[model samples]
Target: MVTRRDLIRWLAAVPLFASIWPLLRLDDARAAQTPRRVRPGEPGWPTPSDWARLKQQVDGYLIRPESPLELCRESPDNAECLALFRELKNPYFIGDSPVLTQTCEWVGAWRAEPSAYVVAARRVEHVAAAVNFARERNLRVVVRGGGHSYLGTSNAPGSLMIWTRAMNEIRNHDAFVPSGCDGVIPPGPAVSVGAGAIWMHTYEAVTGGVGRYVQGGGCGTVGVAGLIQGGGFGTHSKQFGIASASLLEAEVVTADGAVRVVNARREPDLFWALKGGGGGTFGVVSRLTLRTHELPAVFGLVSCAVVARSDVAYERLLGRFVAFYADSLCNRHWGELATLLPGKRLRIDMSFQGLGKEEVATLWKPFWDWIGLQDDLTMMAAPSIVAGPGRLRWDGTARARFVPGLVVFDDRPGAPDANFFWASNLAEAGHVIHGFDSLWLPAAMLARERQPELVDALMGATRYWLVELHFQKGLAGAPADVIAAGLQTPVNPVVAESFALAIVASEGPPAFDGLTGHEPDVSKAQRDAKLIGLAINELGKVATAGGAYVAESSYFQKDWQAAYWGANYARLLSIKQRYDPHGVFFVRHGVGSEDWSDDGFTRMADSD
Candidate 1:
């Protein structure tokens, strides 16, 4: 075993990444004493000279982040602000901005805010320098890669941010073996992605360019490191498994400023914690290597809508779809979302893998025929099942040749042609969230005898807010090997047995703080939030378990530890304490975070 002390020595020996900073050697005795975390203008804050010396250490990569919204605040009608608004809807633009968050704001909670300073990290040394600086000063440090954190863990008003946006570099490997596991683990095809890389670029390199598949987020803009840390799921997760389960190794900068490589062999406990232990909690993962899978022959979508003319008819439609999902659509080939909306509407925006167009159409014929028998149901959309070559599914350059108008490309100056986001995800770009909550829906609800109960729950919930069933987020009907792999992560154990993850939420337009006339309608947002809460409570009656994806859950979630990690919380916390004993890495709801206050600025307990 490579002990943490030995790993530190190894990192120092590497000439390319020698001890960038003297590690903040926190002896066991000193680690027990909690320091009062300070903010800018505080007594314990670092002076200008202190920041300058640290900045020098990173070779001028440090920066002071200024929000683009500042221009909008000064003059709402100005050219720069208007031009900024145009690009605000582009998630690629959002990801690259130091002062922006993919989720602009969550009502009654947090608004996307900038840190006092940002270390625009381009390599492991930059991240280590920032960690060492913040640790010695007892200053709160925030980590933002994709900046898609719904809980605002990645953004804080007066903290230092280790921004990994510039570290995006992707590489495809023919075979990979983790460090110290040459004989213990066999080599296999894999891809090493920088922490800053998004699924869009990853898919393009792995699938489009190399003709192989890698598990990633359905939405292309999600950051690679955060998603894996929080237990990622995608459009075809049932086929392979959660993205975190496929992680073979990670290069992380621990709180102690030691650049360590963790995997199944070296730093085994931290490796396990990184697999589904909430992001921004443990350390800054600079890069990750994931096992890649063979590309399927086809990747397709089935998008259509069914509108019920009456309440009774909607119940029948919901019941039929649920039964169809259990009987045929529960396997690896079927995944993605199907939404049940107000006005008694059923919206199917699902994706499939390894199925032909004709096969998909044939599978849906019986369900469509049943809808035809109902006098109160109307098919609002014709069957639009489109299946194409699997490699083109995420290939921005090649996708348009097959599936037109489904993706919006980044048209900014000097932007890569492959930088684009799914049209379905555009609505989420820079949107002010009203309310969002995700919970796993158990497979037992799909039983023939229990279908009515599930239908009743869905019907009652839609009365309050839109409910989306994300099948790929759960592992109920996945292959046995896939489910077995998923079980190894620290994610909520209930996910392995759930049929789908139900997301009920609402959001508004970009409501940047201090922008007049463009601010979010708080009254309307509060109203919607109440209704969203009601919807989740309705579904909660039959959910049978308390579990929610930490990445897409409520800020007010009461039992977050259990809901996010279930029985794995204790083990994760133990590992957290072992690696980050001095509380250098702190995120809201993260393991060992209960010892600190919500803002991560002060200690709430002593020697927990």
Candidate 2:
């Protein structure tokens, strides 16, 4: 039976409730915005004439609000929309009934307004049609692959948004990895992933039939389309590489609304640019062809301590972690060593294909020596490998564990010495722990203290931490200096090219709060300026210390492009212009958007 505490945690984790408690408690507030009933027999779909008329009417390169309302039947119940709604039979997927003022609002306290929200599209032809329609009308377009955009670029206020949620499709092609569970490989290699397929879904297909597919991202909810374009990272990166590296081909709808099949051989430039160039700046991707890899037999692992919060513990734990990861990068076995602050624990997750205890010990000897673990120490070895066909039967709970916001870096070998040149002291200060190190602390602490049984159950269920790493051909050869600096920060060749939207939603916008949790409007500008200055100073310290900043994870864009995409701005723009001549693809904080990009990019550069 689920306990009251579980209920509390579940409530705390709920999307709308977790952030706002008082608002959730108010029944009157809930009653105010009730669900509107959908009218029955609202026309099966749009007729050709309707589609043509709608296309002809939407002229300007902006969100056609009137067209949207007209597309859908006019009624006091729904707002003005285009006649296209009449054609779309899918139910509107929303957390709440009455639409929030801002569709781009994310966790924390920031609320951003997107240009527009296109009703979710399902079919490939529908996607193609939408792109063509948006381009022909000269409307700025942004596709919403999964709506998980941290920077709020997924949905724009006035620009046309093409949602690909309904486009999820997965199939095994005979030409790709063949499907089976004979505990062995087959002759045929097949893989078919739709543009809307999430990481989890793709994982199911790739790892299902005795065949292993290479992808990234631990979270199952992220759309493959966006993740691939944005250089996805995952627990399995060490063995394979980034999800983009595994990509074979992609069906992309260009800025001009022309759909094209692109791969390494066909349109090599676009393919190269797409690998790590980032998302939205390019065109809408309809489907992706992923490359598969072989699964390991026995994934090995170890845990030194429970937590590492103190200076000594931090140094000991983080130093060892840095050394190990540096070495792992050299071996292409992307390992993750996390330091939990709240629980004061240090854990290392390593992956090796079918390795025994002896090999595991030898590989982790450096950490073992650093931490001084004895031969009799508690070491739990499992015959279980995270990959394989049976992994699909792990149950839905396994799927739920996948979470986003997990930060990653390229801290490979020689990173520390290179960081010394830039004075990046994160490696020195021990703040350069993995994503799980920074997060999972508060929650884990609460779990252990509040629910010891549950915590114990999860103590060491798995042996190896899935080490996800993806390296492009030319990418593996980047200069050591740049790699060293980028390793301290998340701004690598892969992550830099994607739209890592970091939404900073505080309880409210910047203002002068006079003790009542509210800011005074009098000194708002000055207060904001001072606060921003302080934040910049802190980031500058991070950058100067050989560590860099990440705007994809942090909502603020202080040193955005430089810190995020590195020197790929010019190349990205060229791709943008070639694919989208009329600027049909537009995004806030995107490649060329001014209102959002101006402050973030400009300020970061000017500060330097």
Candidate 3:
């Protein structure tokens, strides 16, 4: 008789067997000789009757592989499929399905071609049912909120996908307290946001409905749950705090399909883990309650121009901006200063909350004084600038108008056909000049000299290369201990300590040859890879010893664990073991995910 212990010992003898060892029981492995792939519509896959039963168990509908709503590759424009697609309140496609080809374009380089099922979960019950179903069939599961994972962490090939977009619902809860509070509940207005709620929807509902705003993603389509879970930053972050810092409570569905309400007073460890731990790792968050603040009336200014003609001029301007950023860090202010090379331009956008025009002018006087010393520079300010209630709009229809005013630009351009590699570094106040000198300058020179055509192609195609410096001062007034107290989260501690975040990124279009029939052109691919490699290498030098931002980091960073989580990685791993011992939730580059390969195949860690 082969015992479970015996099977474990046997599997332990061979490294290649590690992937399958966790899922197989002694009896099952002994009976089957070897494992086999389970395809859709097979005995292991749920049958029509099984799906029918599942539909009755939840408050949501179930879609089968053969349903009219199933997007077909051969007949993409099938009348039935089109009608069903249009009717779907929220939709996502499975691997090999026609719709998957379009909907799977999150980051072109890492898009998953999954061969499993996709579930558009609308209700909490639907999510629970999906989790139970996946467990029963021994299927790997991936949860997607906005499907915006740049590393393709949201979807796995051959795994079940729980699409949460349909679960979007936003509500305001004024002065509410949790059920199991040991102390006084924090006062003030709070908003309960659904996991699937996009930033724009929540922004509109909270700001317009309650005359309040919460720190959230600048982009309208970014999901609230994913962003907050990953330590979101935006225009209001410097004033309010990172989005996760405002989290009051959360409803999470764990690996066992049990829904748990977590807060400081209940499941405190999980509460800490959920605040800044990378999304789609710990559990599926059903809803989140966040603190909200009244929207402040403010005066703002926007200016941009090609100010530098020589490298000396460029360096001088960069130094001036760096000094300005350091000063802002000491004095609580909201603004961003950026420089785009080749044109050698400087752009400054600032907002002074609750301040009059004269106050705003007085605050910006030093910056204006510095600019006055430069004879060759000219600043162009936008017209029709006004200040008041109507100035702030958060709805979708106003997205186009509001984004430009906020200087919120899309990093991904010509997206579906183009792929980009990006890296982010948190620069301490003292290291700002070192970061620019070591990273941005060298890369800019290299692009102009060695890869002129590549530079031209990128500039013409996607405005490819950029080095951004974002100023945030939310943590300036707080002491190191206070910041450390907040550091119980999985977000990199460097984000709070740093004065600016430097983003170095580059893009390359697909190198497919028409005559070769979708096959990538090797020469073009090699060239693109080389250019991207240079950018990555240069940026790696600028990254502070502290850490990097997870959201805008390179998927291929060598020291990613330290770069993304710093000292918090160990605690996050411990939490993962306690909550998900089976490793039910896994994403590329997530906690405990080092054991998995790029293809979503698991390999047991040496310690395991």
Predicted structure with the largest lDDT when compared to the true one: 1
List ranges where model 3 is wrong by over 4 Å.
Answer: 1-43, 64-108, 112-115, 299-301, 329-331, 351-354, 380-387, 395-465, 473-485, 508-529, 539-542, 605-607
- For residue 267, model 3's alpha carbon misses the true position, in angstroms, by 1.0
Residues 284-385, model 3: lDDT tens digits: 899999988777766344444546666566556655655554444333446444545446566554444555666655655677777767886655542223
- Better candidate number, 1 or 2, judged by lDDT: 1
Q: Write down the TM-score of every candidate.
A: 0.94, 0.56, 0.74
For residues 76-184, could you state the per-residue lDDT of candidate 2 as single tens digits? Answer: 2343332222211111222111121212243322333444335355665666677776555444456766555555555444445666666778876655532232334
Selected candidate, larger TM-score, 2 vs 3: 3
Global local distance difference test of model 1: 0.89
* Residue lDDT tens for model 1, 1-608: 88655665676677866445255234423544665799889897889899899889889998888877877776788888888887889998888899888888887898777899999998899999999999998889999999888888879888999999888999999979999999889989899999999888898899887899999899899999999999989889999999999999999999999999999989999999999998888999999999999999998889889999888989989999999999999998989989999899999988998888988999999988888888898989976888888767777767776777888998888998889888889989889888889889999998899999999999999999999999999999999999999999999889999989999989898886557857888998899999999999999999969799999899988899999999999999999988898789999889989889888998876663
| C-alpha lDDT (0 to 100) for residue 374 of candidate 1 | 88
Error of 3 at 516 (Å): 9.8
Minimum summed lDDT over a 10-residue window in model 3 is located at: 426-435
**lDDT of candidates 1 onward, in order:** 0.89, 0.43, 0.58
TM-score order of candidates, top first: 1, 3, 2
